[model samples]
Target: MGDYLVRAIGYNGQVRAFATRTTETVGEAQRRHNTWPVVSAALGRSMTAAVMMGAMLKGEDKLTVKIEGNGPIGPMIIDADAKGDVRGYVTNGQVHFDLNEYGKLDVRAGVGTEGFMTVVKDLGLRDMFSGQTPIVSGEIAEDFTYYFATSEQVPSSVGLGVLVNPDNSILAAGGFILQIMPGCEEETIESIEKHLSTIEPVSKMIEKGMTPEQILEAVLGEEGNVQILSTMPIRFQCQCSKERFGAAILGLGVKEIQDMIEEQGEIETQCHFCLQTYDFSEAELQGLIDEINA
Candidate 1:
């Protein structure tokens, strides 16, 4: 499969769960940003979690995840919507470090142990829902898990992983989120805790060719205990386009356009998300100025 997410419930709806395989999606991001292995792992894990959170929204709703850490990687930003479209970028994409004590990509070293995670959700309402939580772990997954429990007041478990090839391309990326519903039985919670303790890192499972469904099965329980609700395709999709950049140029007003035309004869604007560059020739800049005037 290209890339996809799974939405399901387990233990008779006492647990709300999500799982996704984002190898292709993260690979595209790595290619666009030229992220090194540690940077790829950091950005990929954040995107995987953000996309799963996006699935929790209703139609036309979206969310943005920002991780501003004190590490060398600086800040990472991700945007995801209800339709499984996600895009993201890191402030510094060339960061790398020796593996940590556990022999994993030193994501914490890249992400840093300080700073905050902020999530802004646009529910198509007059006011957006925003939450901020202290970063409990530099690892993206634990930080999001903390966000849920502290900011959203929902007890949840989040697992995210990304493996990069020696060449710094994405090898596998995937994650899962499990939430305990109100009034969930104690037994069910204990059961999930036990499974969580024993399950392998999600990236390893994905590297081993496990699908989202299988990942959830391993996390939740046997096939019978989990009820598959729906599946949505996921991908790295950017909302940027030449017209959007043109409109932004128009917003910059005629004076800036004229100055750019005089100085460079043309201008190039690159999108932070996809790194696609849009060029505006002198004529195009003049047209935008004309539109601004009229």
Candidate 2:
């Protein structure tokens, strides 16, 4: 019903898979950013994949996915954590185009055929991990598929889709990821490829009210072959807050706060993820200046 993701091991641990129903989550993003149809698809697809990747982490670990393409939509950035929280935005949310040759949102055209997809992971402590791959397809799914194979050295299949309503709202958004574990039999991989070719798009499945578990079964073939290991709720969650922004203002040092107090009288900061604005009065700015000097 609501947004959630399923992590499962299929074929008796021969393969690892993840599927998520993200309609509501993507809807929240669309409403916040007011993204056009094609841009909505691009952002929705990236968010879907990023949340799943986030599940691969543990504890306070988090990761950010950045797609920089040479198209009208500009660069897109998404951040997700191990807790199933994700937030994202496009450089230009208002960009859109007529349907492509397939009568679907022109995501490839909007994303462009050249660019890079980069992933940066913060593992907490002093550790970090980063990987990058060229944007082979501009379609979010295939680009991630390539990323895993080349950057992470895992053979993977990724399916992502987002349908937009005429009013520029999200109609359906969801996706699935399948990875061929080491020692997987050739027959198992062949079977998954066969089912992948026949199943409907991920967006259509979500539109028909298919749950994430059902999606895994359909993609992996046969209900008995897929074993769901865990399920976690997902949503469009931003870590930004007024207090956090205030702390950032303190980090700007004493002079900047004094300039705002004297010249501007106050400061207003708007979060790019959720579009929530935080206003600091002159008194509050002075307080920050005091803290900085203290």
TM-score of each: 0.97, 0.97
Clash total of candidate 2? 0
Clashing pairs in 1: none
lDDT of 2 by residue, 197-257 (tens): 9999999999999999999999999832898889999999999999999999988889888
TM-score of 2: 0.97
lDDT of 2: 0.93
Report the error of model 1 at residue 130, Å: 1.4
For 1-294, candidate 1 gives per-residue lDDT tens digits of: 789999999988999999999999999999999999999999999999999999999999999999999999999999999999999999999987999999999999999999999999999966699999988889999999999999999999999999999988999999999999999999898899889999999999999999999999999877328888999999999999999999888898888899999999999999999999999999999999999888
